[model samples]
Target: MGASIDERKPMVSGFGYASHSSSGIGSAHFRGRGRSHAPFKTWIWRHWPLLMVGSFGAFYLIHRLSHMGSSTSAPKATSQSAQQLRSDSSRVQNGKVRLSDLIGASIHLSEVAAHEITDVKFGGKEATEVKGKTDEGVDEPVTLADARSNSVFVNGLRELFPGISILSEETDPDLEEVGISAINGVELTHDPWLDLNDILITVDPLDATKEFTENLLHFVTTMVCVVHKGKPIAGIINEPFVKDEAAVWGVALDKATEGADLRVSHGLQPSTEDTVAGADKVVISRSHTGSGADVVSEYLPGKQPVFAGGSGYKALRVLEGDANAYVHVTKIKSWDVCAADAVVHAAGGEFTNLKGERLVYEKDDPMISGGIIAAADSKMHAWYVEKLAPLQSSHGDKHRI
Candidate 1:
């Protein structure tokens, strides 16, 4: 559900005024007031124009003087604000905090949802169940954690960015209360600077639910991606199981002009060094490796593929250069990969489908039928796509739905 341009008038404050029609405040209004002083009233009536002009002149002069004072002091204030911003930006190790200030509430919302998934304990069989199969024919499960976290994400995003469109995986109205109550006690920051026109916000309140149910907490994540005109511009991935400040966020700060580059930063950790040695490594899905092994064998040759769960995690493996590339030749969803795609691209990495085409995040359909291939750099990505495209087209044709 994407918003149209006409419905996206930002709710920020600006200069405005209320006008009153003179007919509503005419002589009839003055007559109701005590007017016993006839001599004064007569004199005032005759001299009213002169008195009004003098009063206007005096007020105008005072207004100009006040404005002059403000003009004189404005630069210093502006300079101080600019200096403070720079000082704040300098402390960031990975992500551009300044550019992401507009989406602070979303980042916080993802973290809140993540923490709820890990920190809260569920009761009985109510905690988990096999929900249904995904478009890719994988058995997807829905957990109390998933529902509650999704509720928080959906409700919180709606509250913070009412004008922006939202798409969440779990939209059952009955389950909303599980997470909506949590938001009442939370206080999140808001920034009114980002343009909301034609923006679509997608959320994966809980990813790797099967891993979570199995107590494999490391792979579980809460994700949010901001898509503008079919491109992901900002993304946040929160690992609730990670110790402290377990979030990694990225913003395509220059997306309007150059959407390819992104500024990525860890929540509080330093940027990890490229530990990848001469022998290349590839990462693929642990649970659903459909055609991934064949892809690595046919395209990567000598490289051994490492298995992992969660698209966000696999993308990070490539982002950290622990793996040279990540390839998947099965169906996937926009919410599962959009945040990771933004982060990898922001850091100057490359992400595209097996056909060597950039994935479009149109809100009308969340399914990305072509699958994905992400790499730490452009050359490595090209290397994989050149070898794998034909094989992918031949075997994974159903994925092209």
Candidate 2:
């Protein structure tokens, strides 16, 4: 059982003393023990520790109550900071909803673009024009399908997110002007977070034009990537000719902090395993394997390298575990790799240049000059980086645009 109050020493409580002796007040009880009742000031000085503690608690309570009753007296900066915090939180929540909607729209646009590609590919004979020569000096071709698919994405996205900038491989200045003029009178939807000036939408309406022209449909893809403040945060890739499944994949990241929904659609989602184990095979570009042979032979010694068309297809090969890594030894255009890079990294993989640096999607530069090396995970990426460090500097002007 607990001891009785009289059996214990006196305790200092609040502004008063707690004692078992009811016959005295203040220090009177101590007088019997040779200590006379001290004056009020002396008593307060002797119990200064307790008084200070009590005063601080009361002050805190009053301060809290003042804040609860009327926050107008608080520092102006503090009130503004609290308001800004709430505003940021609201923006993030709205951003998640808008990003989710954007992902859905991207999937639908990809499917629509796929149909456009299919119609053009099988449409008797596709009239082609030599748009220009690639960085590798090969004649780059464009067909009617390219314009149609580009329109589907550019027109759709501009209508949906009118404030965001778009950079497409097949962006026609005249077409853009027409699209802008068309949407000028239309009341477009607005998303506070996505409507910011820093957002960029990049599109590769038809990733493998050469393969598509040659009826090599398996390598064809429709791709799009979303870059905010120079960072690729979302992506979509659609395999138009793959017969297996839905073939459309997408992912949006930064959900917890920036209000993005970390959700991925279909094939772009991360697998159940904590990490993927691989290194036996490497997927290289079929058309632009500039110095891939020597680099792979020297660094990835025993591994087998398979050459394939389309940057998106090569990236998917690594993501689906058909290959451990995807290595490109020549310069690549930004639009060709941005969506693939985003999709690969979003699924717990790594995508970077030969120097082990991430590719930046700046508005002025549309080229990834250092080539690329994408691996399944960090450990595999580090292994590749260590092995391929030598060739990082060898691609001199060949990689430059």
TM per prediction: 0.66, 0.67
What shift in Å separates residue 104 of candidate 1 from its native position after superposition?
A: 0.7
User: Highest TM-score: which candidate?
Assistant: 2
Please write out the lDDT profile of model 1 over residues 1-401, one tens digit for every residue.
Answer: 75543233222111111123333321111223475778547846776666576567667877887888454411211221212212211212232222354356667687778767865543343377788986557788888888778877765654334335677777633312222222222122221144555577888888888788878878888888877678877778888887775577776545354333345555422222435552377788876665566667766678887888888878877776567788887778888999888777767777898777888898789888677888877777788788776766566664332
Residue range 278-367, candidate 2, lDDT tens digits: 357788876766556656777787787787889888888787777788988777788999988888877877889877888889877887
* Residue 205 lDDT (model 1): 84
Q: How accurate is candidate 2 locally (lDDT)?
A: 0.69
Considering only N, C-alpha and C atoms within 3 Å, which residue pairs clash in candidate 2? 255-260
Off by over 4 Å in 2: 1-97, 173-192, 255-265, 268-278, 394-401
lDDT of each: 0.65, 0.69
